[model samples]
Target: EVAVLANQTTFFGESGGQQGDAGVIKTENGAIIEITDTQKKLGALHVHLGKVTEGDVKVGDAAEFRVDHARRSSLRANHSATHLLHAVLRKHLGDHVTQKGSLVAADRLRFDISHPKAVTAEEAAVIEADVNSLIRENSEVTTRLMTPDEAIELGAMALFGEKYGDEVRVVSMGEPVANEHAYSLELCGGTHVKRTGDIGMFKIVSEGAVSSGVRRIEALTGADAANYMSARENVLATVAADLKAVPEDVPARVKALQEERRRLEREVSDLRKKLATAGSGATSGGDAFKEVNGVKLALRSLDGIPAKELKGMVDELREQMGSGIVALVSGDGGKASIVVGLTEDLKDKYSAVDLVRIGVEKLGGKGGGGRPDMAQGGGSDPSQADAALAAIEAHIAG
Candidate 1:
């Protein structure tokens, strides 16, 4: 479909982490149609789409076409730069690599590639330098069209599970090399520059692995790169001034600052430990052997009882409770905790794990436990704590 001022064209843009391109088109009437947005879609036909706007015009009308010259140029540089970077990555990291996604802006391009390990700063610098070197070498950007069978025969690499028609678009960088020194060549439909040099001042600012085997890279070229560097330098200058240090001395200064910070953290941790000790009291060792269902039961309360400490106390207190039933309750920081212990002699209907599970549930919370001898669980519902205790006391008796 078409209109007087603008025509609808599918453009693939920064959706799904892939950055869209900025371009413009024009009508024959000299009315400029700016292609301000591009998008890629997950659909049947026309994977890439573009939107253009101008004076009101109906569809089914013919309109002239033009892409935003400056924006398109910059985007092409970055997009083409991605190809160069892709080639460099394969050269260094081998052919197991594949493009996960990409974002191309006026001056910067971010590429996500599949790899197992995090890309180090040195590796990113190398990749950037390599791409820039190729650009400086001025590789010709050549385009070729071939049938699917012909592309396969010519040893062109293609994406996995991608649907292709009888004809495909191929973009090549530089002259083809023999076995190894090849520059860059891939099948692509996105717009690109005519030459690698058009992507002035390629650089890789950062790189990191996204997942177990996928990596991400952000790079800049031309003015975007220049601005980033300048901003970084300004930050360094400000920090240096604050520290009364030189530019190169900032790292050492920052390291010393970090050490000071760690020392303060340790001091705070020690103070917290001391405060906890002062407030926490050890569990009491007094009463036990409450009779339930003609079986001796175990119960106790102690201060400063950690979850593990409570478990230990409960284990020791169990023997005294005998084969009847054992239940332990302790409070920590105003929160209620409990553990259940049963004897092997009466393990048939009574289970420590099941007991604890029920205890936590009836208490309006959740809990879990272990074997027939003992299990542990706790809940945050302090109001239901007493009811929970009474329920467990009767549960073991039953």
Candidate 2:
């Protein structure tokens, strides 16, 4: 642990929803200690965390400290962009816009604000355009130390739930308006870019409702934003090529393809139903029967037949067979579904549920319960379908 005095250190601690600065400290003995994180305690002391990988690092040893410039630059870019985004939101959404929460990372930033509804796509586009306009203007960023009352008098915004001392740090961006105040002036302690143009660019990647009356905007800046836009362009180009259409016509092409798919689906379903009735003597499937105790036992397995059409098939078969029992099983792979239908005469003697339960058991499956006239059950193993059908016949025979 290395203690960092206020003005003696250049690293900024983790605060204001922003990550801490990371760097390394080179000791007198040529040993290097990596400082992966910096944090400020309640007592205003900065603590640096890392381990000495080389020679021993003793306390009170003078060391050369350095902060990772690239990482700090990215964080500073995103942090300053967050302030501009807040201002843009307030300008478009309403004066009621207040910061609910925020997270400033090197790759992206998330800003939560008070809003009654989700930001529409049009509103988001306008807000993003407004922010990029400020970036293009290259507005100046100013920081000053002033009393809290004085900062508030200048219309500086203070975050809710934040504890501020009598003396607070005020950060402002953009030129002074008629009120002699910058467009965005907030009582913040986080590090920021020297000018709005230093942010390079700003883009809102997503917007959504986080909670009741609260909305969140996730955005990226600088190289991160550039990379995001490049990736999206590549995806759109690929999709357009696949659709054989220009980027502007891709949506219409996709809609046409979907309509074609639905048409093909309906045609295939009708053809399948027609083919099923060809030799089956019914829409469900072809039925064969065996005589058992003066009752006709009709059974057939309708492979690939939908469950919805199974009942109609059984009913038609019962009408043709007239005085027997109908048992149908259908499905694919290792799954099976069985339906049983009883003739008016057999309904009084043998139960359809009992026959279905006995059939499912042979297939190592479950489910069978209904009136004596009709019942349905399913099995996990389709390999035993033949044996299950035989079991159904034997159950009725006994």
Candidate 3:
């Protein structure tokens, strides 16, 4: 980094939450130095920081200093908008609101204030409207140099913990308020627009908590605000077209579609439950059941049934079997799920958890958990689902 000190300059140093000016300085010998930032040193001098892009610049050389006018203009608008925002917030959120911190840049402005709770959307809208109203009024912005005491006596707000000299610069904007003072008045040294109208427009982009008792609000002004609104309108238009409705009717259309989707889901779930409970008879000439050691055992493998519905299916199958052990396995997308249940009379002789664990281990799963009468488990391998059920049958037979 390079620092250039001049006897006199036009660049504004970084201070008061506003970024410094950035530009170039050209020497008489054509040496170019691109200044990326300007800051204060020892509380007085302006230090221009950058790298020498061209020929070397020596001491006592005459150079032309230039500040980027476009960037400076953007900064001015954003800084001025912060003042208006501060005043409007205090008006709507009570007098306890004071600026805690801030960041004023070319693209946006963030103002941190002492607020205990989140600023509601309704309150933010009102604050934004009040600021824009004042901008539309095109009030003149005035600055005066006076003693700090005199400025305070005139109702100008000073930032806490900021060191101010005997002489301070006071900025005021908008029409007079109930206190017979300007609507917004503060001790500020940052650059700003000549009139409120120069801000063009104001739009609040976000508001959230920054700290325990502080909230931060970010906003845009002028061309940036216009562009932000334009992008949002385009998004709204696209969504409306996709929904086959006008922009004004999009919300209602979406709500109706959501209700219809939920209703269809309920109907589909009921149909699935009915299909799983069908053909549950143990001795209806099907190979679903066998007498192992005088204990009737029913083992069936199902398809496309979700694991969550397995417990209910097991309950229905156990009731139909009358007095036997029932084990069911359902496979979907290469995953295996197993549920084991026993009749109340047989639960004391055989544990459902032990049977399910035996089946789960065969399917590459670790353990199974539930009450002794009923248990559920799953595994990653579905191709071994039949083998897993066969293993359970062998265990019951022993």
Candidate 4:
């Protein structure tokens, strides 16, 4: 059974890679139930699913739900604050506060709001302060169902691709006067608390991007802000206890730790590069053990060679080894790999892909293709590696 999409508030865990909002719904009889997950389907409306009902419940049962109080409060703290951030942007960065996407989870809220240039730290601080003041004032937030034309007349912003019926919900924040100049008015179906005051505190945690065209931000609200601060305090306490130093000195200790980590990362990266260069092969011609048609060929087991890189190596080897072809098969346990390289003169005479198929078949397994110039294949059989190589060489010789 399905319910009206309008009644069920969905989460922003939608297109932006943000997690769904976790909350709860209240029934008509005052049943407070947990809202574990919220999702959207085909841009209709957010769907809310929760705990199973005890008695048999029908699809059309009339119910009124509130967001999980704590989580929804946190979300409101972040969501409303994001609006202030937009206002501040217009003040400082011009009229480019288009929201790309947003996530208002209980722990933290992320906003992918846009601007041409990066917002300076000073500007960010001003925006944060503006939002904090709004939270401090505890502004009232109210929603009403209005005709689409009426909503636009009231200056409500609607998103593109958001399908609307004859009527839409317009959420307004600030004094409840019939035509008061409110802070924000938008068409949304997500769960939000009744008042801005419900949001305890707000902080802009970080700002970044969703894509090249879209800027992004993350903020903390309500209990999440408190929890984040508390967690940092606990860390500071632990550090002070361990070092026998004041909590204020933890900053110096953290800077030193960060420097050490950077040093280790640089060292590891350099070592990896050196090893890759050292172990990779550049072996030239030594002897041609077999001649296929008029082409000279050699066979051997190759190690530490991935298929892509080996093609270049095979080219150099082919020039020196002979004018024909050189194919190598490497295998360990049940897995086997093969690479074949050929010269331009031999394209019509042989196909590298064909060679791979024959090689895998000879090894009692399966494989596939590539161009006549270079090809690679794999199969299940380590024992088949050497035997398959030898069979291909012999076939060429005959």
Candidate 5:
């Protein structure tokens, strides 16, 4: 292990929220060991974890290792973008914002900052825009080693509880000729892009409160950000085409649909009440009334009436009929709705739930249960509605 640690390597180990470099090591004898991860421990010791995929590797063997450059570039871009995002948050949300923690990965970045309140969507958009603007400026990212006091004097932000030696590495991104204090300056030891422009693009994918007074923002940089935007645009286009409207007019079209739906709902409700009144007039005396086993019953099948209106219809029937078992079946298409209501007097003799169950069973459906005074159920076969009502009537007679 010490021999592997002692080997002179150009690969950078994991530090400051950035991932370690990954690659493979080849021995002089053509043996290969895959280096999955590299981490720094005990000051400057680079611990490498790997498996020997080829021949045996002994102590003190000479080996050549290659770092994954593409992966490293991605890490560098995301890491640098975190710094810019931090600066932007502090700028837009006021200096009360401070870095809490972060995770800088090759594919995405997460930044945790201390803020009193949750970030709003508008604020997140502004912060993202500011970060992207900084990337467009292509500010020079510079790193320097100085005393902790000197770094602090330059307004370099330091992490809480982090032990810093006399010499600290300070990372700063800015065009000093414009404003030295304008960019992000922090004490960090992670790898980063050489210039802000290297990030290519910046986007905040999501933001939320991670803890009390701490908010987290997850984002993508470079091609990842561009790809996310492209995919979102494609989804919007598909939705617009489905609605037969252009993307710019989609919101208005959706709003119009909602209004139309509400208007139709009111109209349907009015028509149901009118129809119920007309049916009551036609059968008010004795047309739909019958006597089964000495119990008065009123049975009727109505068409195109919604299940939601069945309860109201049952209520109206209970009020007018005074005493009886009212079984009403109404439906359209292939669906059927059955509602059974018993007057106050008949509720003790028979259960409304039992009546509804009889109807639903004859119609070959499930999910039927309710109270004694009123119960409702639905079935898929509307054509069987007549048989369902007949079954209920037979049950009452028997």
Candidate 6:
């Protein structure tokens, strides 16, 4: 890295939550040094950090310094918008709101402030609207060099942790609304637009909590704000087209579709339960239930049933048997789900948890847990579902 110190320069150093300037310095001997950043050293002296792209340079060489004007313009708009945002936040959220941090960049601006809770969407909209109102006013932005004490006396908001010299630059914008103080006045050293209208527009992209008692807001300005709105409108138009409705009716149509989907889900669930419990007779002599050791033991392996529905199916089957132990296994894809349930009268004689653990072990599962009356478990091997059922029957008979 090469650091160039010139007697006089126009590059703005990195300070006051704004990024450093980037440009190129060309020496008389055709040496091109690409300056990526400008910074301050020992509270003064702008240090241009870059690398030598071509040729060597010695002391006393005359060079031309050129800055990226487009980038600088964008940065100025965002920095000005940040000041308006700060003032509006203090007005709406009470005087307790103070700037904690910020970032003024070419793409967007981010401001961190002391806030107790998250800023709601409605509040963010209002804050954004207020800032844009000031921009629309096209108020002239003015700057003056004043003593720190005098700036503070004029209600200029000085940021904490910033080292201000004897004379600080104070930026003021918009007309005064109170006791001879402008709408926004702050001690800032960052580049900004000459008029608030130069910001063109303002749109808050997001707002969220950054830390304890602090919130951060990220926003876009100028062409970036316009592009953001256009993208949102396009998304809404696409969704409206798919739903066969206009954009104004999209929300109501979506709500109706959601209600219809929930109704269909309930109907499907009822049909599945009926299909699963079909032909399972209550008598002990049937294929579904067999009398073993003076207890009715029912074991069946089925398909296409979700693991979540297994316990409810087991409950219905146990209720049908009046007094018996019901064990059901349902396999889907490569996985197996098993549920073991006992009637209230037989709970003391047999633990559903122990019986289900035996079945789960056969299906390559480690542990199963539930109350003594009902238990559920699952495993990866569906091919071993029958083996799992047989293991449970064996444990009950043993």
Best of the candidates, TM-score: 6
What is the clash count for each candidate, in the order shown? 27, 1, 0, 4, 0, 0
Global lDDT of each candidate: 0.68, 0.83, 0.90, 0.65, 0.84, 0.89
Q: What does candidate 1's lDDT look like per residue over 230-283, in tens digits?
A: 899999999999999999999999999999999996776555433322323222
lDDT at 263 for candidate 6? 100
TM-score, candidate 1, is: 0.59
Give TM-scores for every candidate, taking all chains together and pairing residue i with residue i: 0.59, 0.79, 0.82, 0.52, 0.72, 0.91
Candidate 4, 211-304: lDDT as tens digits:
7767777778777777877897898899888877789887787788899999996776555433322323222133433565666765655544
lDDT of 2 by residue, 218-301 (tens): 999999999999999999999999988899999899999999999997786667544433435222235455677778877775
The residue ranges of model 1 lying beyond 4 angstroms of the native Cα positions read 1-34, 38-62, 105-107, 175-181, 205-212, 264-398
Better of 2 and 3 by lDDT: 3
lDDT tens readout by residue for model 5, 54-144? 9888788788888878888999999999988887788789988878888888899999999988899999888888888889999889999
lDDT, candidate 2, equals: 0.83
TM-score of 5: 0.72
How would the candidate models be sorted by TM-score, starting from the highest? 6, 3, 2, 5, 1, 4
Q: After superposition, how far is residue 218 of candidate 1 from its true place, in Å?
A: 3.0
* Model 4 error, position 292 (Å): 5.7
TM value for model 3: 0.82
In model 5, how large is the Cα lDDT of residue 226? 93
lDDT of 3 by residue, 87-135 (tens): 9999999999999999999999999999999999999999999999999
Model 1 error, position 297 (Å) = 28
lDDT ranking from best candidate downward: 3, 6, 5, 2, 1, 4
